[model samples]
Structure formats: structure tokens, C-alpha cells
Target: MMRATTAAAILLLATVAKAEDSLIEIVTREVKGCMDSEHLGSIGGLRSYNDPNSAEQKCFLGCMLKKFKALDADGQYSAEGLKTTIQHCPRMKSHPDIQKAALQVADECNGKVTGCSDYCSCAPLAAKCLHEGMKNKSFQTIFIALDEALDKMQS
Candidate 1:
């Protein structure tokens, strides 16, 4: 009985470790794509969450959201889909604030997104809209919060 329990525990630990690694890989790739794109990268870069704000930053954020598939083909709210995509992420899965923010991002951003090009323009209108959406207490903050939570959990 003891041996069986020990084996099960080890198996569970391994699965969790793999899931964490997978989350890191997925986020790294998505962020890299957003930062590396000719259009997005030109606007400074996506290398850090902290930097001087510019019209370009708003546009790049929109681009990253799209790349992450947080929006639909018609650029509509798809929070559920987005949630599903990161369901396995340990930090997000365990945090209620993160979950609420994840779902709200679509609500906050959808109405203003006329199209991908709208973000590209970085027009005052578009930037204002995205800023409003970001202020709603959610998705824009997820990456940093989730990263911190994960690190805390590990340590």
C-alpha cells in the first residue's frame, strides 16, 4: 500500500512539472511572435512588460492578443476559448482573480476593436479604447501576475 501511494505521488508530481514547462513554452512563443513581428517589433518591443507607453504599445498589445487567439475570426470576444487555452497553467488555474481577469479581457477589448488594422493605426480612438479596456482590472495584467504566482508557488 505504501509503495503504491509513493508511486502515485511521484507520477502526479511529474505531470505537474510537465504542465508548468508547457505553460512557459507556450507563453514564451506567443510573446516572442508578438515582439518579433515586423509591425509590432517596430513599436519598441514586447521584451518587457514595463516600458514607456506609446501608441505603438497599444497596437502591439492588440497584436499580441490576436496572436494568442483571445479574439475570434471576426475580432469578437472569445474569453472562454482563451481560458481553455491556458486551463492547464498552474498559476492561472489556481487563482480566482486571474480567472476573472482572463474572462473580462475580451469584454473589455472587443467593442473597440474595429479590426486588426485599427490597432495598427494606433489612432487616439483606438488607443483610448484599448486603454479603457485595460483599466477594467484584467487580462493586461495577467502575464505578470501569473508569472509571479508561479514563481512563488515553485519557491
Candidate 2:
């Protein structure tokens, strides 16, 4: 009987560990997909934010805001819309840290230079400010409860 019990416990532990690993895999894959070559133009890639002044970096951040629905048609901000968009990222949508970082990005970088007269300003300011607010490491680490981050971001 003791032998049976020990075997059962070992199986349970293995199952739990496998589940955790799977969860981490899902989140990592989903987030990486966003900045893949296809979408890098919009969302800054790994370390792309380090040089916030570059035109590519600027557009990267600005386009990411647009993609995330943080910016509306007129370039204004909508918290609700932003939340909706963030949900696309598996496990990250409802995370408090992500919400805080996103809000910071919205408040400070949303319209930094989005006006028509200063169209060029939008990219640099948005990218720089957003990069400062949302680091890649923070993004990966915030969604601790991998199960919660299971939903794939809407395409």
C-alpha cells in the first residue's frame, strides 16, 4: 500500500510540473510571435527599444500602440480598447503590472507627437516613452500565473 501511494504521489508531481512547463511555453511563444519579422515593423523587437531615437524604433512603438488599440482612429487614447487589445497576449491581458505599464504608455506616450502638424514627433516620442515604461523583461516576468495567460492574442 505504501508503495502504491508513493507511486501515485510521484505521478501527480510529474503532472503538475509538466503543466507548469506547458504554460510557460505558451506565453513565451505567443509574445515572441508578436515581434517576429512580420510584425517587427509595428512592435519593437528584442532590444529595439534601446535606441528610441531611430525612425524604425519610433514607428515600431507608434505602430504597436495602434495595433494594441491604445490609439483610436484620431490618435486619441481609450483605456477600454487598450485593455481589449492587451488581452490578445496570452496571460498578460489581465495582469496588473501589464495594465500599469500600458496605462503609463497610454498616458505619456499615446499622443506624444500624434498631431498632424508634428506627425514625425509621434514615432520618436511614443517609442522612447513606451520603451522606458514597458521593458521586455517586465513583460515576460509579469504573467506569473501561466494558466491565466493561456488565451492567445487576437489576430
- Quick one: best lDDT, which candidate? 1
The TM-score between candidate 1 and the true structure equals: 0.45
Query: Which digits, one per residue and each the tens of the lDDT, describe model 1 over residues 7-42?
Result: 111110112254446444554445456556624444
Q: Which pairs of residues clash in candidate 1, taking residues 3 or more apart in a chain or in different chains? A: none
* CA error at residue 14 for candidate 2, angstroms: 30
Query: Which stretch of 10 consecutive residues in model 1 shows the poorest summed lDDT?
Result: 4-13
lDDT of each prediction vs. the true structure? 0.42, 0.40
Clashing pairs in 2: 88-153, 91-149
Q: Candidate 2: TM-score?
A: 0.39
lDDT of 1 at 39: 47
Summarize candidate 2's per-residue lDDT along 1-155 as a digit string, tens digits.
01111111111011223444654454445444534633444332223234444554444434444444544555454445555544444434335455555555555554453543221235344444554544432442111222123232322
Clashes of 1: 0
Model 1 lDDT on a 0 to 1 scale? 0.42
How many pairs of residues collide in each model?
0, 2
